[model samples]
Target: MTLGHSTRLIAVAFALAGPFGLASQPSWAEPTQGWKSYIERDYQAAEKHWRTDVARGNPNGAFGLAILAERAGDAKGATEWYEKAALGGVPSAQVLTGQRYAEGVGVERNPVRAYAWFARAMAAGVPNAEKLRDRLAATMTPSQIKEADALAETLAKP
Candidate 1:
């Protein structure tokens, strides 16, 4: 009878603990962990964990990968991952993509497209997007600025 009670208690404990343990493990935890490592400049570990998260289709992982690639001086890889993250709707990625396009970092310079993305990031309330937008506007000709504004307006619509 004592063994039966103990078995029941153990089963109950397992039942209660199992779901909590699983729930405590978030989908983003690994990617966040990788980001922590990246912030600490542990490039190898950051790449490893971030790659694991990327394999699971996490946009944050792609952002981390982009940062890591940039740190490693792999422009192509950084651009690709930044594109992936931006298309995934990561706001910071949108900002970085706009900056890249504006400067012709990995892709050709396209002020209209850069303005569109900066506008998107601005609408998304990323803190410094407006500053970048203003800076890009300053570098553009009146005609180019008009074109960029038009593109940004169109992109702002639902």
Candidate 2:
């Protein structure tokens, strides 16, 4: 069956659900040709496509930009884009953003923020996110855990 534009867009949104491992690209998944160019190693074309999508407020575009920035060793830019995508409700971006916070990559090291993002990712059904959140919780003080839980609650998608 032919997928509608919205359905194709939904597929694109979830395309990064795993670790940069999009094995095959469906023919109709070209609204954000960024992922296609990215897989083909055409960084320039990917960036152009992603930038246009980002301009149009596409979270998947933000996720694509985050991957490109990370590839270029621009930790700060990657973190910014990842956070944008995460806030826009991209589960993979939430995980990456959590890791950035956990590792102090491009952002200050804050276990609280890491836990919060991980919790959000877990709630969004990202596999292994609960493990990440629990692992981080093991190192945090009770008060910190409480704060992280509160933050995660506040940031939960409606």
Candidate 3:
């Protein structure tokens, strides 16, 4: 699907949140209160906390929501939240988003987009992101690679 102007703008903003076009790694030592609630199987409490965080523009909140959605078997909802978190500079979300794109789990499979996300994740120091990107690259035609490269370059701009 072609990204609209606002979507592209959001993508650019997300790209700006990270180093080399993706957000830096977040500290996982202190899980968000929402995440804590989720771990305790308090779905209602976790949703409330995560909703508040999302309202406050906290990407981790989006990440938490994604997890909750996944747990509840909402593949589409989970993917949407994951994309939001990834754009907001969550490295793990980026990888998840990339995987989703690669496999067409929630969204349509788009190798070019998948590669771009993987590139961003790799640049952000995500483990094995490079390997994933390279694997995807192996399946892409030269022109497709060029397109992915261009998209990655655009996303990399601060």
| TM-scores of the candidates in the order shown | 0.66, 0.79, 0.79
Cα RMSD (angstroms) for every candidate in the order listed:
15.9, 8.3, 9.9
Q: Between which residue pairs do clashes occur in model 1?
A: none
Clashing pairs in 2: none
True-structure lDDT of candidate 3:
0.75
State the weakest 10-residue window (summed lDDT) of model 2: 20-29
Report the C-alpha lDDT of model 2 over 54-156, residue by residue, as the tens digit: 7876777887888788777789998998888888677878887888999999999999999999998887777778888999999999999999999998873
Q: Model-by-model lDDT, in order?
A: 0.68, 0.77, 0.75
Model 3 regions more than 4 Å off: 1-29, 156-158
Per-residue CA lDDT of model 1 for 112-142, tens digit only, reads 7888778777766666678888888887888
Query: Relative to the unseen true structure, what is the Cα RMSD of model 2?
Result: 8.3
Candidate 2 runs further than 4 Å off? 1-31, 156-158
Compare candidates 1 and 3 on lDDT and give the better one: 3
lDDT for predicted candidate 1 compared with the true structure = 0.68
